[model samples]
Target chain A: MKRFGKLEYYFAALITITFSNTILGEGFDSTAFITIFVALTVMYKGLVVIDHFMELKEANRYLRMMMRTYFFFFPSLIILSTMF
Target chain B: MSSIESSNTLAIFPRSWSQQNAGRVPGNIPIWVGILSELTEFGIFFTAYFIAKFNYPEVFASGPLSLNTTIGVSNTVILLASSFFMAKAMSNVRRDDYKKCERYLWYTFICACMYLSFKSYEFYWNDLQGFSTKTNEFFTVYYYMTFNHFLHVGWAACAILWVIFRLRSGAYSAKEHSGLEALAVYWHMIDLMWILIFPLLYVLR
Candidate 1:
């Protein structure tokens, strides 16, 4: 069971989001690669919020899994479609 | 300023509040409804965006390039900082540091203001650059999606102000701060939505 302090998770998310811009700026040839990277970064940020900021670290498994699934599944499809 | 010691004079939360509400939904049920509705509304817009993007790849690809990535990144940082302070306010409330909580919320409000400042500048700049809802499919989606979110931020700003007033009025405590927690969750949802929107609209170009 992994848990993070709220401030730590926020910093982690800020860095991830800010960092994605660099990859995106590298020109369009690698847009496909950065799309995948940005998708996964978004997922990680969502999971951190669900787990830490929302304090779902100890919530019911059903609710936890539900939010997790939505965050994981939907953005994923968008990225997949963008790439393919 | 009401001191925490003086706060003890008021009725504290019943000791079993946590144990009683254990295993329930994350926060107050009504907030979950608000959050879900917001998510559903954004979902529809995002679907339309992607559908339009797929059909008009050239426009979607060129769209973000015209927009200023610097403003987008800075706005994201400001919003994340606002969310950070909001979370800190919640943790302070959990610790019975009502004064500290109120201070953190004010900080969050300041960050919200800063976010709006950058956002306003971006919109003004876009207008000067001749981008509008009628410019093209991409701007249509961009203006609609971003403006709708801007509306939510307006509501969130008002809510934070109200909560700050209530915090000063001695309306909450360590063990009985569900309303504060719910507000924090809503703000976090805004941050989460932007996490998706920032990368989708600006970065993934």
Candidate 2:
């Protein structure tokens, strides 16, 4: 039997995380916890795409850091706006 | 970073400094420039989204309730799947599996078509609900942001087709497939942008 490739596994994980984030966010009141949770999920998904799909893991340190920063910055902004 | 190898300092880093020398930017440097510009464009749009959102918290809070979550979520899934297929195609190409790479590209093209179809249906659904760019601040942001993204996806779809044709012509191989890698990266960026947008527009109530 042919098992799933590493990229396939990453894709599955991303899909799972996406749906779980949506369901949990929508199933309950949009509390701070839920909002932060969603933000974190977005960050995780972005990082996966950057590192794996974009093939940035072995990329130049500066370029890799720049991509990572974009993912972190936006999610943090989302959290910040929700707070105040 | 220089690609030169210095054997003497390889041990100090411990994580295989030799491999560290292998680190280089993925795809073409020019494509990275384009990616940066795309990111800036979407970054500005996101800024506007947050500004309007904070200004009218009630409107932002209730905006998503009116949108079609089913279409939005479906499109998100489609884009994610498309990017995955694109990534798979790139991996196959790197392994000199041109046949598999071509197959995966077709899969990605199918996903892109599905996404565009659902998105168009979403616009019609919005029209039925009497939503438009003039609806309100919330709807205005929604329409503009999503429409811009829709256009990007369209361009990316064309690029995928171009890459497919080029591959068929034997333009790519394991030893030199930067063009394919570039398209994959661009496609993933499109998918990543939507990953953020979907939650904001459909789920973050």
Candidate 3:
């Protein structure tokens, strides 16, 4: 079971790479939309890993909250700063 | 007979005989705090990357063009494999298998070396092409973000080496291996940071 979970994580990583590359090959105007969408997808996948695989949900609540804030805020801030 | 018996009894509680032994075992802090600190540091670098991208999107686009995706993907796999070895090392330490722990640690070290080697090659290639920190805003952020990650890789390698040495010396028992715990956490942080970096810098437009 644990081995399967690890393999699934790796599969997700490969998908992310493929998705990002596809976005990169598009035109700039199209690239921005794809990039944003890809970013969101990456963020969602990361959060799922943190919450489930990494067992953050079972961890200290304060720590879990801090991680949630750090992950969401940092990436969102980066994307927004870039876009605007 | 009485004096000899008394001295033999004192051997088990030798700690009461000296002040130095009182501090032998240090306090064990949770390893998660160290991991969090590293995550925050990487966050700052990511923020800088974005700020640069906002100010100069063209430069960012050009910078990505120069990056060799082959090397990027290879390094990503190396780090991912290293994470697995690190986890195995931790598991071995928990199981009191010092030999297996050492083997896994050595494997992790090799992966770290591979990562550093590829990064050095990239840096040399970039430098030869004149894509330096002063080239443009994009190059500046690229160098900064990637170089900072390289530094973390170095630190992690050193930590892994320390854990390996301690394991070899039997300093870490199954019941108490905080060093291994801390290093494993640190290794995961390195992997997690690269996950974001590979996409943002190499793959994304």
Candidate 4:
């Protein structure tokens, strides 16, 4: 079952991540907190998909590094967009 | 073995016995070139969306309310599931489990269709509410962001279909599955782009 490992958890996490953020967001008008939470989860979810699903965990260092770095960097642009 | 060899111009990792060909992109150079170019184009589109949003924060923040968050979240999950199935298909292909690989591809394709249908419904709902690309700057960016992704999804779905057909013909094996891997990578990239798009467009109020 190595192939099936954590597949369910990823699904559960994806559902939980989006809904919790969407639900918790209703309570706070604080855009910063909401955005920070979303960004963190975006990074979390993106990395998970990259390493686990894409199987890039064992991939070439350049591609792995670039792909993971892209996850972290993309959200920064979103936050910066709001600032500027 | 750790580093890939670069052309004579520049080498990344040290020239080692095991890594003699490490410089090449994974899943062949051609697909990497295509994926990178496609990502760069989307990167520009995303940059444009954010710039427009920056100029009109009020419009941006207020726009998502009229749209359904549930639908957006569902679409995101759907795409993620599709990516997972594609990944599984790739793994199965790697294991030479040809029949299961084809089944997984079918699952991924079905998931893709579900996502496209749901997205189409969302677009219809927006249109019924008079939300068009011409609505305003916010709607303009929203349309661009979603539709640009929609177009990519179209491209991915087509590629997936071709990959499925190939898998059906038993053209891929454990050692010769680079084509399948390339399609999987492209699909994952589509999923990757949407993870950011979903929150930025729908949830970041």
Best prediction by TM-score: 2
Q: For residues B64-162, what per-residue lDDT tens digits would candidate 2 score against the true structure?
A: 889988788889889889988888898889899999999999999999999989999999999999999998889999998899999999999999899
Which residue pairs in candidate 1 collide? Answer: none
Per-structure clash totals for the candidates: 0, 0, 0, 3
Better of 1 and 4 by DockQ: 4
| lDDT (10s digit) by residue, model 1, range B60-165 | 8789888888888888887877877887888888898988899989998988888888888899999999998899899999988888888888889999999988
The residue-by-residue lDDT of candidate 3 on B1-205, one tens digit each, is 4764543232444534321322221112346656767787888888888867777877777677787777887897787677767766766777888888899899999999999999999999888888788988877778888998999999889988887878878889888886776677567667767767876787666
The Cα RMSD across the true interface for model 4 is 3.2
- List the candidate numbers ranked by TM-score, top first: 2, 4, 1, 3
Model 2: residue A40 alpha-carbon error in angstroms = 0.3
DockQ of candidates 1 onward, in order?
0.40, 0.52, 0.18, 0.53
- How well is each residue in A9-77 modelled by candidate 2, as lDDT tens digits? 988999898888778767888888888889999999999998988888877666688889999998898
Which candidate's DockQ is highest?
Answer: 4
- The residue pairs in collision within model 2 are none
Instruction: Report the C-alpha lDDT of model 3 over A1-52, residue by residue, as the tens digit.
Output: 3465553565467556544544464334435566666566556645654554
Docking class of 4: medium
**lDDT of all predictions, in order shown?**
0.77, 0.86, 0.69, 0.78
Query: How well does chain A score by TM in each candidate?
Result: 0.71, 0.92, 0.59, 0.78
Model 3 chain B: ten consecutive residues of lowest lDDT:
B18-27
Candidate 1 lDDT, tens digit per residue, A1-84? 757864775677666767655556545554566677778878887887777777776864555776788689767965786664
Query: For model 2, what is the error of residue B61's alpha carbon versus the real structure, in angstroms, after optimal superposition?
Result: 0.5
Q: Return whichever of 1 and 2 wins on TM-score.
A: 2
The docking category that best describes candidate 1 is: acceptable
